[model samples]
Target: MPLLKVVYLSNNTKLYLWKITEDFDMLFSQVKLKDSSLARLESMKSESHQKGFLAVRMLLQHNDYSDFDLFYDEFGKPHLKPQGCSIKDVEISISHSNDFSAIAISDSKVGLDFERLKEKTLRIAPRYMDVSHLKNLSEQEKIKKATVVWGIKESIFKIKNEEGISFLNHIFEEDFSFEDKKATAKLIFNNKEEKFQIQFDSVEDYIFVCAFEDVK
Candidate 1:
């Protein structure tokens, strides 16, 4: 079985996304999922990894590269071929749900994350969201909006590679509204500042979160 949708995120940024609609068994044969990572996943308990693999393979379908040939870094980060360099410097992140798995690829550095976006919202809400963000939310804006904020924070974290960053401290959405499908976030790395564009989307009941940057 093959996934139903592929999203092209950046024409300039070299980013692509795919949504999986296939089962794990069929998903494996379609792309080259290099190394023991595929085998190791079987021993792990990550539903996200399983679904993410399917989502990522869907993107590989359009590229010239094979899954068996692709590999990650010492940090377990994906190493993609760079454009015009005889290699495509495409970085990726993948996520999955019961129904859909989301994949994101980029020419520049990119990061992505996905979660169920429920009960966990309350516990982490105050940790990352600032007072201004909280004040803007309606009493009814608890779950969905809160989760989006968390998604934004996670997206930024994916780029920074840091842990223990608080939504209340390190980052915040610039002009976010849960009603909209998109949000932009700001990140501070040393004295340099970066902006992240986030889009919250769903395939069936699953949430797909994406984040990216273009660096010189």
Candidate 2:
């Protein structure tokens, strides 16, 4: 499968998704990886993790990019080098869960997260989010909502890429209904408060979330 979906969140930001249906060898042979990435791939202990990594490369190739053009910072945030003569820097975020891999490219700082819907996430919701938000929801809805909240905090953390930002302590998501398919959240850390615009939806049994820093 090429791309599960392509979403244009704005004129400058786009999201690419891939459903991991191919086996490890199929994905590995479809894209080329740099030496560092190859070594990292070999070091991975799980086949699922390797498949997710290669699926991301597949998404990159779909956008006319290769692994050579991608690099990671010391904090392990993925970034794309200036493509050709373009002077504008492109920001990118990558995430994958059990059955999906997703990448978000934006003209501004962005973060992405993909999580599978499961009771385990909801079971520990109190550790990372406000359980009160889950009140009055059916069991199935609770699982979905909790997973989205987890993704929200994760996406926000990916954007900040700063230390000591605890999901339970610093990140807070405003109450949002599943029907809205969008919401807002805030990060309160180091005496600084920053807001983010959240856009999310469920794909199959998984939830994908993208976070953009609210500059306004």
Q: For candidate 1, lDDT tens digit of each residue in 1-216?
A: 344666665673433445555666766666656558668667758665676765566666666556654567766666665546455556766555454555566656777666565656755676678536656555546666676677777777777766455557667687566668787888775556777778776544445567766343
Please estimate how well model 2 matches the true structure, expressed as its whole-model Cα lDDT: 0.93
Model 2 regions lying over 4 Å from their true place: none
Going through the candidates in the order shown, the clash numbers are 10, 0
Per-residue lDDT of model 2, residues 101-167, tens digit only: 9999988999999898899999999899999999999999999999999999999999998989899
In angstroms, how far off is 11's CA in candidate 1? Answer: 1.9
The numbered model that scores best in lDDT is 2
lDDT of each: 0.63, 0.93
